[model samples]
Target: MPSLPEELKDLESKLQHTLRKLESIQKALDESTIVVITDQTGKITYVNEAFCRISQYSREELIGNTHRIVNSGYHSREFFKHMWKTIGTGKIWRGEIKNKAKDGSYYWVQSTIVPFLDERGKPYQYVSIRTDITRLKQYEEQIKYMANHDDLTGLPNRRFLREQFSKLLKETKEEERLLAVYFIDLARFKNINDSLGHSVGDEVLKQMAARFRTVLDQKLFLTRVGGDEFVAVAPRVNYQSILAYVRTIQQMLARPLEIEGREFILSANIGISVFPFDGEDLDTLLSHADMALYHAKEEGKFYQFYHRTINQRLIRETILESHLHRAIERDEFILYYQPQYDLFTGELIRLEALIRWYNSELGWIRPDQFIPLAEKIGLMPKLDEWVLSTACRHRKMWKQRGGVEADLSINLSASHFQIPGMAKRLLSIIESNGDDPCRWEFEVTEHIMMQDSAVVYENISQLKEAGVKLAIDDFGVGYSSLGYIKKLKVDRLKIDRSFIKNLPQSADDQAIVAAVITMARQLAIDIIAEGIENETQIQLLKEMGCKGGQGYFWSPPISETEIELLLHGAE
Candidate 1:
């Protein structure tokens, strides 16, 4: 070898420094996230160790191969075309991608691709950096599914329905194809849910959804919009076809469902709306369909086609909902006290406080109408509290005015009972009354008791211990099982009006009433027969050894003044 010049030695030193720097860069790339360099044709030119590990392929196997080796077949041709259009212009493309591994397993990656251009500003090579996000992708998918679907029935939810409707509206061409929207409300679902509990209710809904799915083909979309309510959208169907489908659905729903060794007759109220005829938009179509459903339910338990008249009712309901909150604040509610008499003594014993809503514009709105709306809107707890406190205050006033010794009975809704601190609130009201806790009776229906026995038992037990008498209202009509009655610590059993109305004629009704009375006697619980409209029914209940009775036969639900007059007269 010849002796080296000073310039050549300096050049050698610089080359060694550059090699050290390049080695460090390579080592860093190997340890960092997944990085790959591909030629202009997308053939793999370089892959770091992390890339090989993530794809479950060795560097030697991946280096010479094309990127297609990890193809997951999830992306469409259009997707790749658009991606290439952007990156081929020397721009960056960022997206989530699913890729197959060497072992035939699939993994998701959050990928970013940067295209490198030649000196002419044309794409020459592409560099992609990715992070393994398979687990995170799965979690996101799970959350999306939960948000758009019902866990119990595995059906699409209201949110999903709205999205589908929006998509349909965007794609629909006017006068080209018609969309049929069907609103189905289960006829006896609440009754079944009340009698059998929510677990059985959930099973019933699942089976019902399955049955609904079986009757429709791939073109239809079904969603559960609310408890006991379902909506179906059938695409490219005319009015007549939609009506036929509705009839078919009604027939399927009429079939009996066997649950927990009980045969339950299923029925649905269906309402139909046609696109461009009933409504030109999604909201209008859904609104009309719901209106038609209400009409069907009102007319009979079957199907009905949409009509213009139904729209008016929907508008009215919407107005009601909008103004309901203001109605509560405006004190549009009043309490009516119906006197309950002792069957043996023929003396007024207690006055049951019934809520009545008197709207200035709508006049006297029936409790049946607004009470359920209140429960649905989550206002029942507040209403119940107001009723309790007001009735207690009224009872105190009546006692001070030389009225007969009478307690106040307030009806408690199932929703009200489910609220946390309900027992404490009741106790506080009773304590504030300055009266015997036993004098304040709380009337709860048997349906409410069957919902969650453990929670209901705990709350009722607390109320009972605090001196509030617990009475099971509408007793014989619901699932009045002995187990629940015993577990509930009940002080009174008020027979439902349906049995009382039949009285001596129907043998089955007589048997049911007699059985309930016998059970109450055996359990040492007092019995009160409500809805006693006739002398014959009253006499029959008295003969049956019922303890207390109240109905129109005594007097319709009266105001506090009227009840006071009745009590003083009885005294």
Candidate 2:
């Protein structure tokens, strides 16, 4: 026992060297990424520096703490249950997880967890390695947003709407709540662009988007389905609630907008469709809402609830819409002119070019019904081009006839303003028609002027340079400011029918009309009052020094023949 052999002494030195290597490995493990070793029960036996750094806890603090110490509460309890089941069966589990740091900050990590088995293949300890990937997750989110959102309005695009609609349909049950889809189209946005320019039109769209946001709850999902058209999806709401929400939105939209010192009163036509009641699927709901929206636009401004009759009308509309896509190619669209009279001189001053669609199956479809539908479906631009080109041709023809000069006013929508090269396109249309831009008047709403002053200014400047006349139609209903009015290089302000209908009776109404007339006079802007029904209203407006007036009291919106007859008699 006193003396050892040389071989035994050599074995002892080897053992000492092996122990040193093991100690070095243990030190390396302590500094590695989220190195964790736990007992089968998931009690922490060891945690590394990296784990402490990510979890905001010291090794000592985590050693006695369970895995729950870093739980971010993001994963469901079932997630943890499944994780435990897998590890208990001696399988490795890997996944990305969100965990709370020691200071309550959150981090995302890719984790690989392994369960070690004893000699009998029973569970012993578990080891986990994790790498932080929060930045990567953020980048992924950014890319997703770019793909799903409208670049100009920052609202969900049509693609996103379809995806969300599918998901929502799956999640909602027939009994749980009703789903409603609202189709919104801005009224007369095109007129604004034609007169003031696209820059102003784009500004109007942005402002409208912002106002649309305010009209809904944070939970409401809104999407820009097309130019000047938005779809709002209200999930888990009752019919009453949906109605209330739409009313609120209508009120918000009707609120006057001020831009460049001009007051723009903007109105929207909203159509709504409910789930189960309207359709069981996303496509049907959207289609029906679109149909209802068209009817609302034709009927009047504001919102309209969906009904089954809308579906019948929708089928014809779909046919019309499908044909509209090819209408330009087929040459099935035509321009019809209606003359506007100079009240005092009894002569035709201008002619408004209106679009009419002749479908093979539907006969002649009036623009009052289909133009808004085209706009909601993104066919307005094509329709607008047709109107512009056709009107220019007609104007040239009229000019060739005995020096007959009549200004042409072509209606445009807000969406057209957002299109690139709109100014160039207008100029090309004018040149192609061989018509003078100086004799053309583009009518727009005040809301477009209030949307963005810079864009409005630029577009207006371009149009003015092209020698086009700018007119603000449906005025005194939008947010108008003297400042914006001064900035807008418009020549005319047309009073809206709502004000005209109530004029000379309600003190508030009188004040609004008086104020508008006064403002226009000061700006040297010509005033045209629309919707005069009674003689008293006409007299009141004429006494107020209004320049021109149009209404049922004089004549309803009629054909060129009637307008010519009226004008000839007056002359």
Candidate 3:
């Protein structure tokens, strides 16, 4: 055992070490934590400087007050009850809490409560320790906001849209009301995006969202799901009124928007599905709306409402698209030649090769029925190649039979014409089939203007340089193409059949026919009037200086055998 002086020295060192540790801990608590001590009855007895600083309270004012002085009312009574119960049992409790400042501002805290017990294990005092986490909570809320909103447009995103839709759907069902889910996509948005930069596109979307907000009011909910698509949900409305309101909204949307001095006319294709009629659930409603939107795009209509038949239409289209893949392999296609006659000389000028499909399952399908579908399904290139090869072979066959030879005019689908190296491919097909380039011609509709103009000009120039003739079919139908016709250098312009169906009996038709002929002459482009069914219409076309004509008056599109017979008759 050590002497008395040694024991006293050791006790002094231990006491000094404990005092230094307590000082360090007190400093740490003051810097980072808000410390407060209260009696077991919950009256505040003391508060550290950190608590007074954070709560905007003086130590004197907080000393006798309970935590209710800074109550935010954010927590329920049960929360405080449970917290009190734990502390009363000589246990610890921890949780995140919101508190009010003396200035009525809100602050967040990570809080813990400790019970100090007496010799009997009964709580005598309660110590509450809290860390100010207001800034951290703010950051967390900001992250949550970004996750639910579109960054570019600052609109509620798909996730938030679905959540709000769920709540609205429940209420709508209880009210026996209807809800419309509108799926909208811009029509020429892709072309605009490709032509202009994405910045301009973003500006357009922002302005569009602002415009939508004006028309939406409080009843309609709008969200920019993504890209050039948006969704609007309107609840507690009937069908007809909803449709009318939607139309007004569309009219507002269609108004031209000017960005950086450039004007853009945006058109939207809208699809609407009503709850309790189209679907009882969100997924089913959205799918039906998407199908309706697809139908609107396909039919060139601005909007469509979901109906039972819409699904059937999609089914038939899908089946048609599938059949088109195997069409060439199964030899389901045939070419019918429509004769173009010289209006003045009454002589056969040429026959336009038109494709007709006779599906084994669904009899003969019209070109109007399957041609656009084929293009949409990405079968145009293959379909056009087959037509070119078949037409070239048929022309060679007709010539070999000692038949009168004229150019077999073939109509080119817009998709095939706009493809790069189209001229080279056609020349190769012509050479392979042993057909003369000068005796064959290609025709395109006015839709070619939508393609890259420079590319089109180059392709057409190359084709013309190789002795291949070109024509613009369905003239005067497309309003924008007529002014730019000189760029194409087409050899012939075919008057659309709509103008001729009314014929000389319709004064508008007569004037249009006369004007088209004059325009054709001025541009050195030969004009052909189609859909002629009577001699009166023929006389009117001739008088208008229309150079060539073709329709039922001469002959409907016929087989090679009939054309061969006609060739013999001509000889």
Looking at candidate 2, what is the lDDT of residue 304?
82
TM-score of each predicted structure versus truth: 0.63, 0.58, 0.90
* Stretches > 4 Å off in candidate 3: 1-17, 36-46, 60-91, 100-107, 115-126, 134-136
Tens digit of lDDT per residue, candidate 3, span 289-320?
Answer: 98999989988888999998989978987888
Model 3, TM vs. native:
0.90
lDDT of 2 by residue, 47-77 (tens): 8777877787887889977988989999999
TM-score preference between candidates 1 and 2, better one: 1
> Per-residue lDDT for 1-571 in model 1, tens only?
5557977998999999999999898788777678999999888999888788878898888887887899999999999999889999999999988999989999998889999999999989999988889999999999999999988888999889887776665555543778888888888688677767998998899889999889876678899888999989887766677777877786787788888898777877888888878987778888888888888877674877788877777677677777677876898888998878888788788889999988888888778778777777888888888898878877777778887878789999876776667798778876777767778888987778547645666777788888888888888766767877777778899988888888889889988888889889999999999888877887787788887999998888888888777767766
Which has the greatest TM-score? 3
Angstrom error at residue 405, model 2:
18
lDDT against true structure, model 1: 0.83
CA-RMSD of model 2: 8.5
Q: Estimate every model's Cα lDDT from 0 to 1.
A: 0.83, 0.79, 0.87
